[model samples]
Target: MHTPEHILIINVTRIGDTLAATPAINALHEHWPQARISVVGSPHHIEILQNLPGVVRVGALTKNSALFRGWLGAKHFDLAVVYNYDQALVRYALRVARHVVAFRQKSPAINRRLYRCVDPDAYPTVHITEHALKLPVALGIRGANGRILYRCTPDEVDRAKDRLVGRNFDGKRPLIGLQIDSFPTKSYRDWPVESFLALCRRMLARWPQAGFLIYGGPAEMPRTQWLKQQLGDSACLFAGLLSLRETAAQMALTDLYIGVDTGPTHLMSSFDIPIIGLYHPRHPARSLGPKDHPLNFSLDHPHDAAPSSEPQSMSDITVDRVFCQVEKALATRGIS
Candidate 1:
C-alpha cells in the first residue's frame, strides 16, 4: 500500500480548526501504524494539541518566518496535508514532501497549484468534526469516527475545579457555563450580550438550584464585567480568570454550555457536556456546527441582517430564541 514513513499535517488556522484536525491525525495513525505523525501549528494552537494521542510532536510556526519551513525541508516528510490554503505555506510544504494534499475551494490558487487539491464541500453538510475527517478520506484512508476528540488529564480537571470551586460555584450543583465572547475579528459570530443576560434571568428563575459560570479571555473582560452588572445575582464572572486549559477543565464540569461560534465552544464539544450553539447566517450552522455529542443545540438565522464592516451583529436571532434553547437543555436534564 500507499503509506509514508513520516507524515506532517499542517493546519495554521484558528484553535478550533486546529483541534478539529486531530481526527485526521488519529486516522493516519490507524492507517500507518509505523509512520511518525507530526503537526505544524502556532503557539496558541499547540496548547490545544498538547497531551493528545496519535501525535508524536507539534512544531511551532513563528509568524512570517522560514524557521518552520526550514525544519520541514530538513526533516523531509514523506507526506503532507495542508488543511488551509496559505500559498506561502503551501510552497514550503511542496518543497519538503513527496506528496501534498490541500483543501480545494476558498483557497488561493497561486499556492494551491503546488499540491493535490481535495474538496471538503462535496461531503455531507454536517458538523466540523465530520468535515475534518475528510482529510484522511480524501487520501483513501477510511473508517474513522466523525466525533471530535479532546482529552484532558485527571489532574488538569481537579486543578481547574480547585481554583474556581468555592468562590462562586458549588461543584455539587449542575453548572451552566456561558462563553459571552468570540474572537475579536469574528464579532459577527458573537451573540448579543443582552440576549445572554435575558437568558440568565430566565434560567436563574427556572433552575433555582443551578449555578452559572461565565468565561472569556482578557479582551472580553470588559463585556463580561458589563454583563455581570446587568446580571446582579444570577451568574458569576470567570472571564480572564483562568488559562485555556483551565477553561477546558471547567467546561468538563458543566451540565450545559451556551456560547458563540468560538474556539472554546468547539473545545467544549469535545467533552460529554451538552452545548447550545449560537450561530450567525454568514457562518452557516450546517457545516460549521457542533457534532453529535450527548446533546447539541444550535440557533441560526440565515436570512437575517448581514454583518457590519467591523465588530457588529450578523444574525437577527433574538433573546427569546436563545431562551427557548436554554429551556430545551434544562428540560433534557428534567429540571422543569
Candidate 2:
C-alpha cells in the first residue's frame, strides 16, 4: 500500500486499554510522519490522547455513535486501524475508510472485509502494549520505542506544583502516590486496604518525612479516606476531588508510586517516577506491567509462579515484599 495521507485509529475502551494503544499509534506516526492521524476513543478517555505527538485530532465515539457515523459522510480517510472486536466500530470503519485492519471478527463475512485480519491468538501472549502494537505491525510499521505517550502543558505542571504546595506537600521528601483500588469490575486486582496502611507505616518509619498522595475515584473514596485518617497529616486524599488530567499532573510531581494494576498505574508509567505495581495472578505483571521503564519494580502474585486458570488472592503479596522494593527504589534515588 502507498503511504496513506490520512489515518484513523478507533479504540473505544477503558483508560488502560486506551493508553495501551498509544504505542501502536506512535508506530503509525513514525512510519508515516506526514500523515494526519486521528483517533476516536471513549468519551471519558479521549482526552488522554489529545496532546499526543502525532495525533492531529482526538474525538469520542460510542457503539451508538458508530452506527450512524459514516452514513452521511464521505470516505476521507485512506486507512483505518481499529482495536477490539466491536462489530459496530468495524462496520463504521468499513463504511468510511478505503482499507481497514483489525483482529479477525467472529463473523466470517466481517473477516473477509478487512484489509488485514490479524489472528489475535496467532502471536504468543505478551505485554499489553505489544499486543496492541500487533495492529500496526500488520502494516509493516515498526520501531515504536515501547513508551506510552502523555503530555502535560507547562501551565498544567505549574498548577500541579502549586496545588501540591497548597496541600503542604512541597517540603516532603520521598513523596509517594497511592492508588488504593482498581475499578469496581476488576476488584480482584485490588490489594487489601490494610496492606496499604501497613505499607505507609513502614515507609514513614524509614523516612519520617515521607508524605503520601492518595488517589482514586469516588467509588473507592471510603478506602482512600480511611488511609488518609490512618496516615494523618502525612497524607493528603485526592480520591473523589480531582479530574483525571488533574490527578495525572499531580502524579507527575511525585517521587514514587505504589498501586495495583489499573488505569492510573498505566498513567503513572508514562512518567519517569519510580513505581511498584502490585498485580494479581490472572493478569500478572508479565502481561500488564510497565515496559521500557527504568524504575519499574512490579510484583506478581505467587499464583503467577505457575500460570493458572484458578483465582488467587491479592493479599498474597505481603507488605514486607513491597517494602523491600520501596527500600530499593529509595536507595536508587539517593533518598537516604
Cα-based lDDT for every prediction:
0.74, 0.89
- Number of the top-ranking candidate, with TM-score as the measure: 2
Q: Name the Cα RMSD for model 2.
A: 1.5
In the order shown, the candidates' Cα RMSDs to the true structure are: 3.9, 1.5
TM-score for each model: 0.84, 0.97
* Residue 197 local lDDT, model 2: 93
Model 1 C-alpha lDDT versus the unseen true structure? 0.74
Q: lDDT winner among the candidates? A: 2
Which regions of candidate 1 fall more than 4 Å away from where they truly are?
Answer: 71-76, 104-115, 119-131, 232-234, 302-315
Off by over 4 Å in 2: 122-124, 307-310
